[model samples]
Target: MRINSLPLRVRLTLLMAMILSIACFSLMAALIYTARIVYVAPQLVPKVSTSEEMGREPLPVTIPSVPPIPSAPPIPSVPPVLIEQQINFASTGFLCVILIIASGSVLTYRVAGGALKPVTDLSKEIEEIDENNLYRQVQVPPSKDEVSRLSISFNRMIRKLEKSFTAHKHFTANAAHELKTPIAAMLARIEVVQLGGPPSLEEYKEALQDTQCNAERLNILVHDLLRMNADLNVAACVTFSAKELFQSILSELAAEVQSKDIDIEVHLEDIPVYGERNLLHRAFSNILHNAIKYNKPNGSIQITGTRHPDTTRITIADTGIGIPEDQTDKIFEPFYCVDKSRSRELGGNGLGLSITKAVIDKHSGSIQVQSAMGMGTTFEVQLPNASTVY
Candidate 1:
């Protein structure tokens, strides 16, 4: 049988059994060898006397003593009693060695199984967990041991799973509602036209314009959602200076900046950042767009950049409608809006910052906001310098 296919406990038990059995058998064999070396009698040869020193008389005498009478079965090479003793010793030694090997294997098997019992229980617990019962926590081992630590970790992981699952469910519902709202309006407008004999030329044009606007809003929302949820692992193929990257985004929003008559000041330092151009563009675009979108007309905006030891920092300070302290943390979550009515009125889908944060995180950077209501806001973004990235 292939050991690979065996259960962990069985494999462990067998491994321990094999190791103990080998050791026991080796020890028994060594004892037997030592007994033979130290306890067995050694044979000694008879010594011969020198003939020159004995110089004896040549008188012949024939004396056939008792030896001629019986050559009897040459007395057993080893005494019968000794042979019996040796046989008993050998038999007893073999029996003891066999018993020791058997008992040692059994004991090791049991000990190994006991040591792995906690792991086995953990496995069983994990196996029973599934989507339907993600809230069911694994039973933590009572002892403050490795097993308990593992159980605790598993519990934390499932808790996160539950939270994510809950969030996903919430997102799904909100997304459906958000999508449905615009479509329903557009459909209602068209149905009115259809029932009213297509209306006058001007009325038809008005309806088409409204429909087109809603369609565009829907398009932007769908695009933003796709981007926020995309597996967009962009490679750092090009390195761009921080100033130019920010300028490019600002240029894209120039029309809005013009419309708001917002004053922009640039104090950019020439610091190189390593990142995917498109991703950084999108991220900076969002930040600046937010700055532009929420700012009071003719508000002041400042863009600044600096070089730090490990990172390049870009700060965007805007005299826009500041976010409340409590809502700042939630701003980056998908579909979260501090002012739901205002967000809807402004056509904000609350996905831009979510996508921006994801992009920053992907580049191992960070973005943070400091703001107080009615006082304006500042956004700080830090990304690794070209030399330090990777």
Candidate 2:
């Protein structure tokens, strides 16, 4: 097989085995060489006495004539080399090396597989996850190893992605539903006017007014949708005074405040907040407008701003028909209206709070609502202070 085509475990095993084989082969060769020097070399040389001088003359001695001495037994000669020993050793060492290579490669393969089991499991789990199976999570190993930690982080990232995808689908469906209403209204009104041939000035005026109103609503909704989706580059974000922001929002909605005959009270302190000014302004406008739109005639509304070293809080409280306790948690969801009929009467598209929440989220801030049925509702927004931002 091609080396590159092998699995990581197999590749690692083969590489490790090759390294160990090279080392073992060198060690075996050294052992054989040492055996030849210690055992085989000694037999190749005759044992010569140092006392016998090669060039020295033999001493003259009186010789006995023809004396015959009987020897009990003759000494056997020792073999200079053991070819069988060398052959046995060489064969054994070669067999041992082959055995080691075979067993070691298999053992290393097992070890590698054990180490990579988590990766295999993670891959399988990821492959199984899709839109229908987004809730599936990779099984986390109990051991606090790198593999286990990596799996945990992958699961965390997948969970975040799943949530984002789900929200996107929901947002898309809600936008379609919201846009459908205004467009349908305009179409219906035009069809009606066309069916009624050449109407009177009053009738034409009313029909035109309704159509124009629906068209304007459609335009506003489209603008808000675009704004919500448009990426706000954080590099352009800056700190602006919270005090001035609220005052400006109040001034902009002064006509609405006056028409409702609502009492507006403000207690604000100069404070800097970190965010995109336009998005923050939009968020603040939504909250303040909701307070006004839902306020009781001749009722009271309170706007308070406080600053801390790390955070700033803005509270918009109004004495209006409050949201139900059970539904408070879902009020921030896109196109989730507490009172659908009442919301339609007030021309509320239900995207206001969704946009506000998105803005706050973009700034890493939070918004919460406090309310009870028939009692007043309070929306409190908390933003990171400019001083606390990096």
In order, what is each prediction's RMSD in angstroms? 7.2, 9.3
Across 115-224, the per-residue lDDT of candidate 1 in tens digits comes to 88999889998899877887999889899999999999989998998889888997888888889988999999999988987489998998999999889989988988
Which candidate comes out best when scored by lDDT?
2
Model 1 misplaced stretches (Cα beyond 4 Å): 41-87, 229-236, 258-261, 296-299
Q: What is the C-alpha lDDT of each candidate?
A: 0.83, 0.86
Show the lowest summed lDDT stretch of 10 residues, model 2. 72-81
lDDT per residue, candidate 2, 331-364, as tens digits?
8888888888889898898889989998898788
